[model samples]
Target: MQVPDVMTAIEISTPGGPDVLVPGKRPVPQPGPGELLVKVAAAGVNRPDVLQRRGAYPPPPGASDLPGLEVAGEVVAAGQGATHLIGTNVCALVAGGGYAEYAIAPAGTSLPVPEGLSMAEAAALPETLFTVWINLFERGFATEGEWALIHGGTSGIGTMAISLCKLFGVKAVVTCGGDDKCAAALKLGAAAAINYKTRDFVNEVRQLTGGAGVNVVLDMVGGDYIARNLAVLADDGRHVSIATQRGVTAEVSFLDIMRRRLTLTGSTLRPRTLAFKTLVAEELRATVWPFVESGQLRPVMDRTFPLREASAAHARMEGGDHVGKIVLTV
Candidate 1:
């Protein structure tokens, strides 16, 4: 592959709305030790990208200033000890710069783009997969035959949760904003989908679980939902917070948590240590890659836009009308 000196990337020209995402030229980054330089075919648009655009989430120290978290492409170059990956198709979880024509990815975090998956679908996997796996399964401890309540049923994270739950035999009950989104979630393998705009998700989940309540809750909408989430958790249930879309802080009853033996926890993936992310990549390769290769696991795509139309992509995401993952194709 002929590597370029300069590449087009979507940059946050200023901290504001989606219109702030502007296409700009940047020097193509070089791969450091244990890194691969990928010719980016597609990059997944995520909530963090939008936050970064609005100045709410900034790139970690030494990371690229561009806004993309996952990308799928071919490895065009590699640093020492990772030369074997050159010329291979892969989708990788990146710290930043995925919105560019070229992006550097950690060699350990890149996974093979299997024959059955398209570049866009592969691009959509890493962020949501790593997030749901870490929070819902590893931290929440959702297991076979257990019931889980997930907010944002039709969003990227919600759909991935539903798919993983179905594959692992966990029953997923999700909350969506509209009837159409709820229907979409049900069709995507959720045990039940609640239209939160019209119905009380707490009562719906309780009723759906036959009054025993859910064994776990994967929450993106915090604030009042935190207390309501606790209301619907079964004894010894786990509540894992992945985002605070509604608000950050909430009042919770310590007595209620103690009485039910409930657990509350959360994490952000971007600032984590490289070694920890590498370990997660290895675990996903061992456990989840099989399903992906077999064509059983795939991202539910909402739409795609040209790389230069990244502002439009951000607008679509913030509008909250997209049902699944959105991608920017190079």
Candidate 2:
């Protein structure tokens, strides 16, 4: 097949706001060994992408300077070691380069899209779902019947966490900003939704758990939430931090941690070795993909914009009013 000479992309020339994301043309990237050249149909816009646009989190090392982290599309070409994935409709968790007409994806990180999902929905899954699964289940050891607290309850990660918890019979309590967001979380199988603006989530979580606190807490909000998170943990509870939207620095009580026997941990999807991501992909394919295929687990998309309108997509994500994932249609 003849590949196009150039492809349209959303480029951030300098760090700032959505205005920084300007549409531009770039040569189509070729797949290297163990890679697949994907014709991107849709790409998810994540908070990290926004941070990257602001120059706070640049792509690590050899990863694309382009913003997108997850994409869904058809495989148009494959490198020498990626022959088996050619022509597959795949959704991949990419290191970068997804905010374009075409991007190269590592073969091992690409998975066949669930039978009935659209490219947009598939694009929305990889980053948030991968983050939630790795932190909550892989690191936190969340199991059936255990209570889990997910901060940012109405977010893409939070919604996916709630759905997976529901599918596995685990109880989930989520924290969001408003009543509507709380209601949305509840509808998505959060056993209880706490409006962080109106209520103290730490106290509400304790009360909801009958003063026992939760077995695990997935926190994206850092800073002040840190001290309170430690206070709300059950004995032996796992607290995992994936992002620090508020701030990273905080003063917390070490005594509380010691007394509760808590385990505090966190991870970023990027920067990990390819072997680790391949393992995560394999685990998701074996354990989580089945539920997605069965429609028991679904991507909750709040909005979408055309690839040319990437600025608007970023703005919507920053607005914080969205209930779930945001996507850029290509």
Candidate 3:
């Protein structure tokens, strides 16, 4: 296939609300060595994209200014060493530039789209899958037979964690904003789900664990949740933060951490080195892809928008009523 000279993309017009995201045209990005040029069918709308539009999270230096984290498409061309990927359909975790018709993906960060998934569903996989595996399974060590407490149970990451727990043999508990979301989380395979609006998450977790606490905590709500999150962990429990939806600054107690031997860790994907993303891709292909193919691990899609209607998609995401992943279809 001949790669196009120009492509449609979403650009942040200003540092403001959802209205800032505007459809624009730009030259299609070329894949460099060890990369693939994808003809995007769809892109996943993520919280990071929202942050970037608000000018809270800038693209790491050298990355495109476009706002999107994951995409699903067909490889139209490839760089010298990545010719093997040409003509393949794939889903990729990109640093940026995903909200476009044509995008470049480092070969290592792209994977074959799971069999029997729609383009929108495949587009929803990369960001949440990568984030969940790294935080819940790797860093937090929420392994088989252990217990994991996840915040934002209706979110993309939360739904992934909850659904995978059954397949992985981990007991998962979660916090959601409403009764409907709590029910949704449970239906997706959570052992338990708490409505944060009507109940206290810390108390529910404590009760669910018989006061022993969870083995790991996957939290995005930082600030005030920190102390409570620590309090709800088992001895030596791992607490991993991926985002700070509430606030960042907090007052932590050394005594609490020292007494329980707790570990608090967090990570952001975009700024990491190419080698790190490549390694993550390797790990996912080995450990998670099978689940994806077997129908055990599946994407939870909330809604989709035409690629040009990206601003409306941003509004939907910021509205916070949608559950699971939102996508942009080209």
Provide TM-scores for the models.
0.99, 0.98, 0.98
Per-residue C-alpha lDDT of model 2 across residues 205-237, encoded as one tens digit per residue:
888989999999899999888888887889999
Backbone clash pairs for candidate 1 read none
Model 2: per-residue Cα lDDT at residue 184? 90
Candidates sorted on lDDT, descending:
1, 2, 3
List RMSD in Å for every model shown. Answer: 0.6, 0.9, 0.9
The segments of candidate 2 whose C-alpha lies over 4 angstroms from its true place after superposition are none
Give the per-residue lDDT digits (tens) of candidate 3, residues 27-142.
Answer: 99888899999999999999999999989999999888899989999999999899998999999999999999998888999999867888999999999998898888888888
Give the best candidate by lDDT: 1
lDDT (10s digit) by residue, model 1, range 38-139: 999999999999999999999999899899999999999999989999999999999999999999999988999999799999999999999999999999
Count clashes in each candidate, considering only residues at least 3 apart in sequence or on different chains.
Answer: 0, 0, 0
Better of 2 and 3 by lDDT: 2
Candidate 2 residue-wise lDDT at 328: 96
